[model samples]
Target: MTTWVLLRGLAREARHWGGFPDKLRCALPAGDTVVALDLPGNGALWRERSPARVEDMVAAARRTLAGVPHTPPYALVALSLGGMVALQWALEHREEVRGCVLINSSLGRFSPFWRRLRPASYATLLRLLAPGRAAIDRERAILRLTSNLPLAEGTQQAWTAYALEAPVSRGNALRQLKAAALFRAPAAAPGVPLLLVASERDRLVSVECSRAMARHWGAPLRVHPAAGHDLALDDPGWLAGLVADWKTRVS
Candidate 1:
């Protein structure tokens, strides 16, 4: 049996996976188990302060995985900040990871501009958008940035509700921004097969970032034309199918 571990991006909880887990499980062949973890400051760990550094988050992830019943050599699928963490983990614990998939993420060394401005700009933006109303508006703005799919009224409302409920503190958000800004993949990636997924419409992290990583790592690259930064949320079925296919190919 194979084990797959999922990691989510900034300010997002495991619930942010939406229906992707179930969808992936259905699409996956039998004898595979899926585990979606809440990063230190989000989801099930929302009450905790966001970690101050990527290493801190990585430690938390290691501890979480250690508690899981599965043995070593798990497949890792990560998005955005989660992708960065996954890359670092694969580098540090190469022998324990079987395969990796990164989505809408970048290596810190790739984009000089983003690396420079991310900390300050993200901090400012978080402060400016920390209120519940501001968070709702940010969600709308995010919807605009990534998706052309006309979001159903009920779906939008539900997203709005979740946004309001999971409002991130400015300080914690800043910490996450700092972690993202500072993260860099190791000089060489793990030897395991890797899949890099990019969204053509992602405004947060450009497709070029993913492309560069894929080129550097010699990993397979996949792109989705219409999906945005929140590809999993925007199209869980598509993302799940891709994950299942990647699992099969890598296995």
Candidate 2:
């Protein structure tokens, strides 16, 4: 059985993936398994201090996965900051990773800072730092910045609940940001197979980041015509289908 590891980005936790994991599980082969992991200082690991380096994040993730009953040589599906960690993992432990799929991810060496994280999102990101901001408002602002399509009716409420249940401290948030900012992927691609997925209408991060990485790595890229940075949330069925197809070809 192939084990699929799902990693979310930034201050987001596994719960933020919502129904996407289930959708992917169904889309993959029946015996395949999906595991969603929370990075340090997020979700179930909220009390932990976030590492300032992406490599440390990879180490922490490996520690967490050691507890799970999964086989080696897993497929990694990561988004945003988690993508950096995934890249590091593949580089550090080539034998343990079979393939990687990065969604809306950017590297420092690939694109400019403005393109990596669009200026349009700076205000919302800054406002989120204000004290006493309600969870619903924070989640709403994030949704507005990251999603191009309308979400489910209670998406705000559910995300707010996630925020309240496992709040990521501001310090941890900054640490994670630092990790992302400092990370620089190798000029050469990792030895394993890679797939880069991007959104043409992303508001938070420029699609060019993925485009540039794909060109540099000579990896295959699939662009969503209307999705946002949160491609899985915007069009999970499509993402699932694309992954299913790619996995079939690579496997």
Candidate 3:
């Protein structure tokens, strides 16, 4: 069975994956196991201090994977900043990472900052930078920016609970953002197979970043014509389908 290690983006944890894991399982070949891990200062590791550097975050992910009982040759599936971590891991530990699937992810070394994070999102993002905001309101704002799909009141309520239960402190969130900004990928792409997925309608991250990154890396790009930045949440079926197809081709 192939092992898939899933990682979420800035200020988000494993629980944020919602029903996407199961959707991926259904799409992939049978017996493939999916494991979602939380970075420090998020989810299960809420109280821990998050690393301010991307490489250190990669080290922490390595440690977390080492402690878990799993087979070797993991496929890293990550979104946004987590995608940055996955890219680093694949390059640093080539033998351990068989492939990577990057979603709405950008690299400082490849794209400009404005494209990595769109200028349109600046005002909303700045408001979220400070602490003391109500959990529900924060989730609502996140929902608006990240996903185009309509979220039910109950879903927002659940997200609020997750936000409250293992809050990513404003300080940690900014630190993570700093790490993402500082991370510069190698001039040459890693040798491992990579599949890049992007959402055309993404509001937070410009889709052009992914397109240009794919062009530079020589990786295949799959565009979800109308999804938002949170492609998994906006259209998990399409995302999972593309991943499964890519996996089959790579295998």
Candidate 4:
């Protein structure tokens, strides 16, 4: 049985994944397991200082799982900045990474800064950059930028509460962003199995980033025609289904 690890993006915690982890678990084989981990400075580990480099983040993740019951090599399913950490993990510790599914992620080596983080999102992103913004307002701005589809009732309120309970420090948020901005994937594809997933309507990041990564890495690519950057929030079922089908091939 495979052990699947879920990782979220910049300034986000495992809680941001909402119900997607459970949905994915249901889609997988009965014996398989799913574990959602919080990067340093986010979720349960919010008190820890976030590393400014992606490689350091990988080290932190390895440390987080050390001596845990779950076994490696792990199937890493990650989003945005988490994707960068997964790629670096596979490259640095190939034996411990069984496979990777990078969603709505980009590589500095393959895409320009503008496309990596679209110009259209600059305003919304800037609003979130303001320190001391109310949790509900911040979450609302994030939702506007990341999701194009209708949300479930109370989604916004719940996200607001999550923000208040385990708020990401402004310094930590900037450090995470710096890591994401500086990370450059190796020119060669990672040795492990890989998949690239993108959202056609993503307002924050250009879809071409994923396409470029797929072409450069010679990996399979899947696109959701209407999903936004938060594909899990927009359509968890579709993401889960794709992972289920891809798991069979990779396994």
- Count clashing residue pairs in model 3: 0
Q: On a 0 to 1 TM-score scale, where does candidate 3 land against the true structure? A: 0.96
- Itemize residue pairs with steric clashes in candidate 4: none
lDDT of each: 0.77, 0.91, 0.88, 0.91
Instruction: Kindly list the per-residue Cα lDDT of model 3 for residues 1-251, writing each as its tens digit.
Output: 78999999998899888888999999988899999999998899889898999899999988998898987799999999999999999888899998999999998877899999998888767655555547778888888899987653476778889988888887888889889889999879998999999999999998998998898978899888888999888888788888899999998
Candidates 1 and 4 compared by TM-score, better number: 4
Writing each residue's lDDT as its tens digit, candidate 2 over 1-251 gives 78999999999999888778999999999999999999999999988999999999999999998998897889999999988999999999999999999999999999999998888798887654543446678888999999998796787889888888888888888899899988998899999999999999999889999999999999999999999999988899999999989999997
Error of 1 at 224 (Å): 0.9
What's the lDDT of the predicted structure labeled candidate 1? 0.77
Tens digits of lDDT, candidate 1, 1-251: 77888898877777777778899889888888899998766767766888877878877888998887987787888998888888877777888788888988887676665632333234334542366687667766655654555553575666667767766666777788789877866767677778999888676667888888887777889999988777887888898999888877766
In TM-score terms, candidate 1 sits at 0.88
Can you give the lDDT of residue 108 in candidate 4? 96
Off by over 4 Å in 1: 115-129
Misplaced by over 4 Å in model 2 are: 131-133
Which candidate model has the greater lDDT, 2 or 3? Answer: 2
Q: List the residue pairs that clash in candidate 1.
A: none
lDDT of 3: 0.88
lDDT of 4 by residue, 1-251 (tens): 98999999988899888789989999999999999999999989988999999999999999888958887999999999999999999999999999999999999999999999998887776654555547778889999899999997888998888888888888888899899999988799999999999999999889999999998889999999999999988999999999999999876
RMSD of each: 2.8, 1.0, 1.3, 1.0
| Local error of candidate 2 at residue 214 (angstroms) | 0.7
